[model samples]
Target: MRTAALLGAILLIILGLAQGDSDALGDDQPMFDVRKVEIAGELKYSDPNALQQYYDQLLGSGLFDDSMGNLTNFVTRPPWIESAKVRRVWPHTIRVSVVEHRPLAYWNAGQIITAEGQIITPRRLPDLPLTKLMGPRDTESVVLDQFSLISQMLSTSSLRVAKLELEDRGAWNIQFSNGIRVALGRTDILDRLGRFVAVYKSDLSGRIERISSVDARYPHGVAVKWKLQE
Candidate 1:
């Protein structure tokens, strides 16, 4: 009879171990399961449905062994999300905050440049009429800086820079909103720009539609090219 009792006690201990294993494997322990997920952010480009789905996964087999680090990393994986903050409430709740990248302009042909000069490739492009900026890889900061300065300089004029390109040879060129292109060459970019602005405001503003291109490499004067008569 003592032997039978010992076997029964051993079986009970084995059952207890099995139950602990089931809990560790994320089997719903009701009280420990995540019941709510709260997200906060000014979302513009990131997918809201995907965010909800990701969080819903937690409701099924959750926070039992999940760390806050994993949750934070998941929210920040989207290219548009610049940063994220995550918090876990005891028992069954998680709060997440995300910061999205503010797009400044279209970069290259398939990426976007943020106001902070970060280049990110997103799943879709924005429909906004943002000017396009182009340069070789690793030159995003240089191109963005020049665009800012040039835009600021032209703020007083009706001519807005619609496109800006920096050649691999260090030459720069700009296309104005009126479809006129200007070559700033390899040196004295700001000086050449200033000259072009002066000429544009004084001489070309009235006849801008007839202009094709302006070569601003000359030291004293700029050479204007007119479009062929149609």
Candidate 2:
């Protein structure tokens, strides 16, 4: 009984000494307090000042008390941030490295889609000349893939895709840079695109400005809608 009691007392004394050491460090070492934060990254859309505000709570905190994982998660909470890393620098500085998502095109309803098919909705959309792609819910990757294919198909031609839409019924529509719209119904989309390209090069390229819309759903040929005499 006496031996167990002595061991318990020794354990309490050891714990008390550890607590005292921690308290002493906190009180006597102002150099251990977080004094500066460094963020390094290529930020095209995200503001560095705004990102620094996330670490404001860590300021004046003892370097030992700050959690690196929590700091990293907070910096990566923004939609534009793809990944982030946080580390303590010596006695008083916290350093963070961040990677941001690169936008590929404008998605439905003011959202931006990245090359890897990530949809991000920032508070304010950026004004870029990128093509617009639209589709039903949960079909972002599908629409982006189709758009890429179509863009590649039309790469040799002078027509640039301004916008592409995949309707709920699976029909595809494309709007060209010159304000001409094309309808490719649910079937044989590539064949319709091919026919349009042939007809455009053979018959429509010279007077493209007068053409309003084209229906490429037919297998044999495409029907062109010309602008009014006005």
Candidate 3:
């Protein structure tokens, strides 16, 4: 009877040890099984549904592991989102916050320029009322920079550039809102622009109706193209 009691006690101890190991393994399980995911952002151009669906589907890929690097990379994959912040809310939730890019100018078929002159082609392009900028290949930043500087210089002037074009041959053409086009050759663009601005403010301000175009290729002065009367 004493031997039987001892064996029974040993079996009880073994069972208790097995149960404790099982509970410890359960404690190491995946952070409550990812019950919910939350994504928030000030989206001026992105579709909320698309973002939600994409992130929700990513749950199966183990993105719910609450890894900061994985979450950040997934959020920044969208073209409109310039940057993102990711966090794990603990227990069963993941959160992502994002910032959208501010469109500076219209670029090409589907691309747009940012204030920093970076080119981005988003998944969906929204129709924004902005000045059009066109240039040769790999000249997005150059054209954007020139547009910014010229726009600043013309802020006090009456004419506003509606379209700025840069050709492969290094020529520039600016069409103002008042239907006046200006041709600035490759070399000495800013100097020629300064000379033309002076001319517009002092001499051609009143006679704008009769002017058709302005050529600032001359070294010292600009050549005004006049609309001849019939």
Which pairs of residues collide in model 1? Answer: none
Per-residue C-alpha lDDT of model 1 across residues 1-230, encoded as one tens digit per residue:
99999999989986776576674544436435577788798888878877677666667445556676777777677788899898777656877788899999999988999878888998888887889999998998989999999988888888888899999999999998799899999888889999999998888989978998999999998999998999
lDDT of 3 at 189: 80
Candidate-wise lDDT, in order: 0.84, 0.85, 0.81
> Which candidate model has the greater TM-score, 1 or 2?
2
Kindly report which residue pairs in candidate 3 clash with one another.
none
Per-residue lDDT of 210 in model 2: 94
Model 2, 1-230: lDDT tens digits are 99999999989986776566685455555536777888888988886677787666678877777477777777678888888888889767988788999899999998999866899987788888889999999999988988888888998999899999999999999999988899999888888999999999999989978998999999799999999987
TM-score each candidate: 0.80, 0.81, 0.76
* Alpha-carbon shift of residue 77 in model 3 (angstroms): 1.0
How much lDDT does candidate 2 score? 0.85
Model 3 stretches astray by more than 4 angstroms: 1-35, 63-66, 228-230
User: What are the clashing pairs of model 2?
Assistant: none
Clash number for candidate 3 = 0
User: Would you give me the overall lDDT of model 1?
Assistant: 0.84
Q: Model 1: how far is 63 from its true place, Å?
A: 1.5
The TM-score between candidate 1 and the true structure equals 0.80
**Ranked candidates (lDDT, high to low):** 2, 1, 3
- The root-mean-square deviation over C-alpha atoms between each candidate and the true structure, in angstroms, is 7.6, 6.4, 8.2
